[model samples]
Target: MTPPANAPTFLAQHGWEGAEIQPLAGDASFRRYFRVLSEGRRAVLMDAPPPHEDPRPFVAVAEWLAQAGLSAPRILARDLERGLLLLDDLGDSRLRETLDIAPEREIELYEIAVDLLVHLHRQPPMSGLRPHGLDQWLDEVSLFPDWYCPAVGLDVDGAGFRDAWTAVLRPVANDGRAPVTVLRDFHAENIMLVDGRAGVEHFGLLDFQDAVAGHAAYDLASVLEDARRDVTPSVERAMLKRYKEAAGEGERFEAAYWALAAQRNTRILGVFTRLWKRDNKPHYTNFQPRMWGLLERNLAHPALGPVRDWFDRHLSAEHRAAAWAQAA
Candidate 1:
């Protein structure tokens, strides 16, 4: 994780003449992160190189989330043309790892996260953002048939797959509740526990450049039905109840939560496959079984009948998680 060629110049311009750069982490995307230490100060350097990645939307959304009183990282400096950004260090205490080390805090930490969503959904959706409504939902889930089916050597009914998702999601789209800002990738890994901040401010947000003006239930579902981690069913149920009660939502929200959770899991199945096959990231295959588990649970919901039936007709038990287990 070498720093980009112009990183030293960028740091020098930002008044950090001799910073120590250490690799932080990379995600499923082309974006890379590094920790910068100079004197006694620390910051994060985001390398979102041109053509493959852009840093502007991240800047805009970070500002929007901050203005909304959420804990998105503060952008210290940026060079959009070269796709470099210096951001406040949110530290290494990720929500996922925190839970891993102390399972007893699951409910407490999750309740705070749920409370953050309740607060975030109260605000109006940010202006000038793309909508992640029915159309986007359908488009995204297509990746399952587009990539996953082919990878498993199982021919699926692509048209039927779309029809099933549409049948399930159309009602969710028209469920009368207005759209809120959907932090499209609001999972445990993308969250950090800031040391000094208290309450919801303690949880810093990340990987939200794809934030959309979409269903309020979407982010809630994303956090609970995570692909990389096993959120016990009891915890998921508790958190769902927690969010619904806090937000004053009822049956319709429940329906949309399961429907969108299935939609998201289905899309991720294909996304991880695409990452492995096309993007040369085979390690993503390890998450497929977990995705399958979440999707299976989601399909059991009454609203997802069409999608469930479609899966039964096309994808079999052997073709699902079992296949991925072998691949992994």
Candidate 2:
């Protein structure tokens, strides 16, 4: 794809005139990224067009992560009004790509990724971040009924679904444990394996513009129980054990981990379906089976009784398969 009309002016103003700009792979969000090469140096230009997307939150969070000694992209320059940012080129070695080439490194890579989260969780609560608690979880999961159910011809009782989620998620929202900065999309695709970096810094974080002050377990679940790729049960189990031991949270951590996993996967089901039905991005549906499997695994936990019952009553086996089959 061609760069935006103003991209040349933007680059020229930043002393990158005549730079080679090539489109980089985009994520599920509206933001677009480009790799820029000028003067034998490389940088990434983020084109977060206005109205649909904003760059300020990303700027703030990037600063926060940098201050915390994490490997977030350095903001070389920015034009928030124009929704554009020139950032340090973190390179093309995403954990996903690296793992695809060297599956043997999955455990090693995930340990580093988990250690990064463990480090973040130990830090004091971040200021200026929104809470990703009960209300947020409910609002996200509602997308399933709002978009997916209708698209799959399943008549859903939206109020009932919300109530069910509320019952299960209320304790989580009210839990006394202090919230930490949750990088809302901490998955393999969003993590770059930086060479020559030490410890957790070896993992370059991305797509964290939506970071929130939420339960630590949310990001953990986002990583281990990813929607875009299959993280083997053994790896998931090992990572969970590593996190629990490293954070020293014990059984409480286990409960929160499964609960958040259920919530995240539930929300993804709707989000993916919405991408297909509303955004015309049907490829997202391809992950429905994996999402459903993760949801089921989490819902099996006794703590998720209400949510399990809710699914049992509202989403019959056939109804569930209807959505899955659509993707297949």
lDDT on C-alpha atoms for all candidate structures: 0.92, 0.88
Give the Å shift of residue 166 in candidate 2.
1.9
Span of 10 residues, lowest total lDDT, candidate 1: 319-328
lDDT of 1 by residue, 267-328 (tens): 99999999988998888999988999899999999999999999998887888864466566
**TM-score (all chains, Cα) for each model:** 0.98, 0.97
Runs of candidate 1 with Cα error greater than 4 angstroms are none
Off by over 4 Å in 2: none
- For residues 160-253, write the lDDT of model 2, one tens digit per residue: 8888888888887777889899999999889998889989999899999999999989999999998878898999999999998898778777
Candidate 1: give the clashing pairs. none
